[model samples]
Target: ASQQFKENLTLVATHEKKLELKRSACPKPGPGQALVHVRATGVCGSDVHFWQHAGLGPWKITDCTALGHESGGEVVAVGEGVTNVSVGDRVAIEPGVPCGKATCNFCLTGQYNLCPTVDFYSVPPKDGTLTRYHVHPAGWLHKVPKSMKWAEIALLEPLSVCLSATLRAELKLGQPVLITGAGPIGVVQLLCAKASGCSPIVITDLSSERLDFAKKLVPSVNTYQVDTKKDAKTAAREIVDVFTNAADMGVQVMPEVTMECTGVESSIHTAAYATQSAGLVFIVGVGKDFIQVPFMELSVRQITVSHLFRYSNTWPRAIRLVAGGVIDLLPIVTKTFPLEQADEAVRHSADRTKFSVKTLIVDGEE
Candidate 1:
């Protein structure tokens, strides 16, 4: 009976085209795993990228792949040897399942985000949880507070990313921070920064609509709308001017901590340029295989450049932050759609004009 009623939406590819939402039977949890009846799954930017671009960077989607990672739901059943949680526990799923072998440097260091054997959900060749029911490792499920909504719980994944970035930069209270790209992750970083007591948070983006949304989410964040279509040099010059002027007024400009959330080369360069001498620059965005860094300037200024992969050891902190009312998630959820309308939801997420910050695929109504 469990196998008979299980249904899932899969991404299938054809000779000439690709199709998403082709349904199939649900899966059972293997050993040390749990089957979750998905209540809410957020449509992430990476999900949209998979739906449209068919892959992310080097990972290719050659076969049917489910498309969701940001999700929260109730545990329905657990496999043998599981004791951390049980049926009916509300949870926020951490999407990455890393190999915990002690031999691996990443695992040994507790930086499992960089584990070589990491299998991330919603990534190509790996089925994700954009369905009625899904299975995940028991250890990756983080219990959520009773007062938190499924929508807010779904944000834990993105929040983890921001937390990792902040942690990497050693973000401190009352420190000025500059974030590039006010997209979903960028805006979430702004929220996390504010909640962590970082002051004078500033964000820049190409879309006025997105910048407006960012303002709505965190009014205290100073925002700038730049024309991305302009030449990279011109754009960088304008940003430099803005930073210099802000610095002149004794306002914290050229932030001590810079979170580069946009993968665009120009934005990365701008972020590097905008950082203060000897400041920390945390690169959170995934870009091309090779990027041209301003080595001369970087060396001259002695800036600290750090990179981020998927988050590690951050789910619990993210959940607590949202549960404790330190970060408000309601403003970031710009739209919602039923599970059956997942296709439309993905399309809306890809369209910036729709003001889509984070779209939710609702599997429950009540």
Candidate 2:
């Protein structure tokens, strides 16, 4: 292991969403670690968020750091005791590395995503997978078929998220479901729900273009163009009339579960109104520190609300679903760029005037 292996080209995020490509010293794999030759990485909303704020929540990007989590790569080298993956293994990178201590109850209970000390990539200050070479715990890398394209494999991370939300929300066969927001997460949720045999799947978005994109991706998913000008109560009535509600006043039907992908307060309120009594409203979107909620209404109906921090034990299922042909995410990918153009790729993905579902940065053949 020479100290002069090679300098890695890394994408670093700074204040005010500025991104710079810099040469970083590539380090050797330590015990139980794998030095990955990153093939592709997806730019996520959170990536843009971190770039804009120089950090997220309480974590500030003082020193700056690379920011990516959705990643797929090839193992170029493995360290001692790394048995599951070896050199040349193509894999998806699970960015959250929990402090695998047995003393932690969350890890023991298979909810490692909740581990207090989990080090998630791109969460400000932590070097992420947005580089040509990255060293990650071997256990966090899941082997994928070589047949899977690099971007497709990288998408397994977000797919894992939607799958986790689906499982927790109890989406099942022939159940009506409502999803708020038509962003990439919403589209992926639609796919996961459609595969779960959810009946009359529905999605809403403020932008008609995004809603249309969701329907194009999944023809069965019904779409609603949200009127942002309308108040939450009026929006709720419209949504209810469109998705559920029978002719009889006494026999009104509503979605059994609601996926609130937009953290907008009004959208959350609409979700509360559109769901059936005793139903669950699952939130996966990051919003303000505190937004007003319709607690009285939810309390009266006994509707339970929950949230997703990240995902755990979902990569294997995500792999099985995509690899076994349950769903194809290639369409959701709007574009790809070579690693050299990562800055441009991220900017394009974040541009509102420009339309893009997902943009990927891939390591081109040297």
Candidate 3:
């Protein structure tokens, strides 16, 4: 097959106002690669950030770039040396492709999320899967069950992120947990934690609408609506007191594990203060390069802090968990649009008042 496919809609950056949809040709797969018929591509927060800010952390956008990474599709063609999947097989593409060389410590340990040679899709100069068709390495594709919905399958990438963070926290069964930020990633973390056997999960967010949506997915969860402009430490103390039953135990706070999902600096500090002594604080949110952390308090409390990037060695487990009904991802997708309306979908994702948790661009729908 030739790479001269039709011009499809793609979000491009030019250090200007925002991402603009441009017409582009379908890219061909190289060795060990497969051409995927894009079915559903998710609009992530990072995608919005890249569109507005033109970069994330140290990664900058110097050229026109397609911005989407959470996606799923069917295999339309395979390059030479590809053996895992054939044409017509439904698969979820892991957007990050790392150099699988043995010399790389991250690859050797199967923790390729840390691999420096990783080429992540949707970042600068890397065309994402938002177009009609995309080509990716077969090694990064995971076959989806026929019974799974494309929208749910598209979520495997973000779920892998939550799984990685939860794994780093080393959560135990029946342990109380608190998650800051009730956004898509935060809700996904709640689901992953529940699947991992954590109990009494509590989540905090600024919007009551998001908290309401979260309640529908996790009915038994304890949620608190926070004022983003207020002092997070005071709010965190109040929440911790309520969870710890300070009225009975006289303890200041509780929760064995705290998963900070909001990249906001205040939320990070709040999570640190809210965590129990000798507990773990997993920073799942991607914040600025540096922030003032309460190291002295953490030292006295013996709190362990861990950070997360995208994900690695987690897709198989996440797939199995979602397949086994341990985690229901259907609720995460709040809206869907056709590929022609790709720009609208991205705009909806950028506006939180639209009550959009996850917006997927559907290329083909009956």
Against the reference, the lDDT scores of all candidates come to: 0.80, 0.88, 0.84
Please, what are the lDDT tens digits per residue for candidate 1 over residues 15-96?
2235456776767788999988888888888877776776777777776677888889888888988899898899998989
What is the TM-score of each predicted model, taking all chains together?
Answer: 0.91, 0.95, 0.93
Candidate 2 ranges beyond 4 A from true positions: 1-7, 15-17, 245-251
lDDT of 3 at 61: 81
By descending TM-score, how would the candidates be arranged? 2, 3, 1
lDDT of 3 by residue, 1-366 (tens): 433356656666556747677876766789999989888888899888887888877778887678789898889889899999988898998999889998999989988988998989987667777877788989999998887788878889889999888888988888889999999999999888787787678889888998898888888788878876767678877777667662245654488899999988888888888888899889988777789888897899999998888888888888888888888998888888998888788889998567888888888862
For model 2, give the 10-residue run with minimal summed lDDT.
Answer: 244-253
Model 1: CA > 4 A from native: 1-17, 229-252
User: Which 10-residue window in model 1 sums to the lowest lDDT?
Assistant: 10-19
What value of lDDT does candidate 3 attain over all alpha carbons? 0.84
Off by over 4 Å in 3: 1-7, 228-230, 245-253
Cα displacement (Å) at residue 227, model 1? 2.8
lDDT value, residue 130 of candidate 2: 93
